[model samples]
Target: MSKSQATPNSAATGAESPDAILFREGMSRAAAAVHVVTTDGEAGRAGFTATAVTPVTDSPASLLVCVNTASRSAQALLANRAFCVNTLGAEDLALADIFAGRTGLQGQDRFTVGAWEKLETGSPALTTSLVSFDCRISDARVVATHHVIIGEIVGIRLGERKPPLIYQGRHYHKL
Candidate 1:
């Protein structure tokens, strides 16, 4: 998610540069675990499908999640100052689409499809997730069009170890 930006070469051409296009195409081939990051607080409830979550350290039990600034859930996630990264299993493909905005279900409505519960941070943790990292936002930085949030893990909920849901070649796969 913290990919280095392509230098500003499109100003004259008014089109995406070749390097940026190729980078995206190459990245698409790289498989990543799917996750539904959910949050709830004064900003209400919000969730989104993300492949940008990763661990930063374990001493303080921290992880990083990247969210697009333009996403509808961005404001709530930032304002809430907490979130849960629910690592999906193979069975959760439809749930991923629901949270990813493909179903047109906005805000709290997306929670209707899943069995969710709050952990230490009061963020919604999917009961069926392979694992749910409930965290408090420790730090945040804006890089390009995304918010790179570092979260301190305050709790973890482990579910059955099942085949993981992955995204690659712009499609969902199970492994």
Candidate 2:
């Protein structure tokens, strides 16, 4: 089964313990889309992969993205108040790993994984990504280990026929 679709009661199948039931349930219920959030401002250029993006409103065109409070990209995005969401293609796994810290790239260096450019909003966007959304911060809130950042999309770039890259259960794929 796909990691995002893992059975919640694996232990019922004799594969996990009851204590981990809630944790497994969390994994099972989390259906996410992987996207790279990028920014460039006084803090310099930076990008990070996230699966926490979600649409919030259609009329005003807002999206919510949860970012780890401790990440550099998170810090930069907050400071900039502008970011680009680069939806990856199936072959962009390496780029995903690079931005996600799985490939050892850090800070601004992570942006070198692929071709990048900028949109009208001055947000850095991946040139070969399946789609890119340039956004401006509308509001934000810090809750526990993550920051819920809401943005209003001001521009968009949709690429050619490219499938999206996905991440779940610490694995990557497309479908």
Candidate 3:
């Protein structure tokens, strides 16, 4: 018989927890589609590049996105109560960098790079995106350093068929 080693539970034993760097490094290995999530309304227009969005259900047609609390668009998204998830095409890498705050563009300036239109929720949708999901905020909650925002789909716009932009290992990739 082999000896089994007992692992200490961090929550119970109050041991040192895994650091944020380690968590991010692990998550970086998971490939995800790139999207620019936008919002406009009483909170003013705002957006940011994100990869944390995912479909929550099909019955009511809903999805969720995790936004960093410090993100420039977080407050606007929460206040506007609506958003659009524009899935980027492989050729849209420049647009992603613009919205991700890598080009020094902030606020409305970031939108100047793309042809934007509004669907049902009045959030800006990229005309060249692979697809856009317009939604109204159904719920939100804070978890760790991010806000988990749930959106109920109100409308959808399909653009030209193209390969989606993917991010993994801390870099952009095309499939």
Candidate 4:
């Protein structure tokens, strides 16, 4: 997890700035899908939990993933050049917690949280995920406090009538 940094602002007087408070407040209200990102590299197999995953565009079949530089898994993803985003289900709370850094499991240890398999692109897709996207990263940009990764989807393992796990107000919700 990336630690929140104090942004220097001329308008702000105290420790917390208006921009920081508003950003957190906005994120707190916005519900997001829970996903586990996995990658295999020459260094080793690595995976991490991410809630900042979103579909960017379909014209090029692409999506955006925001990864914190503080995470070792981010480096692994950069080295591997491929990754899979496993969209969680309502029953995947245990798996989500494990990957979300709430269970104290790091790196490959988190893989033991659930049954995993590989897609055609060789990225690890959870066997029980609601949906899985196998992608090769096309570009990466470090913006703000995260690395915004752009990936081109080449394969998809879609589920049937599966609802996604959601996170809102710092808590998990089932859709």
lDDT of 3 at 137: 93
Model 4 scores a TM of 0.86
lDDT of 2 by residue, 1-175 (tens): 5665455566467675434565655665665678999988887788888888988998788889999898878888999999999888888888888888887878867876688889976888998888898999999999978999999999989987767887666577688
Worst 10 residues of 2 by lDDT: 16-25
Model 3 regions lying over 4 Å from their true place: 1-16
The full ranking of all candidates by lDDT, starting with the best, is 3, 1, 4, 2
All candidates' TM-scores? Answer: 0.89, 0.83, 0.91, 0.86
lDDT of 4 by residue, 87-167 (tens): 889888889888778888877788876788888767789988988999999999888778999999989998666778899
Model 4 CA RMSD to the hidden true structure, in angstroms: 5.4
Error of 3 at 14 (Å): 6.2
lDDT of prediction 3: 0.93
Per-candidate total of colliding backbone pairs:
0, 0, 0, 0
Positional deviation of 120 in candidate 4, in angstroms?
2.6
Candidate 2 lDDT score at position 125: 91
TM-score: model 2 vs. ground truth: 0.83
Residue 141: error of model 1 in Å?
0.9
**Once superposed on the true structure, which residue ranges of model 1 sit more than 4 Å away at CA?**
1-18
Alpha-carbon lDDT, every model? 0.93, 0.83, 0.93, 0.84
Best by TM-score: 3
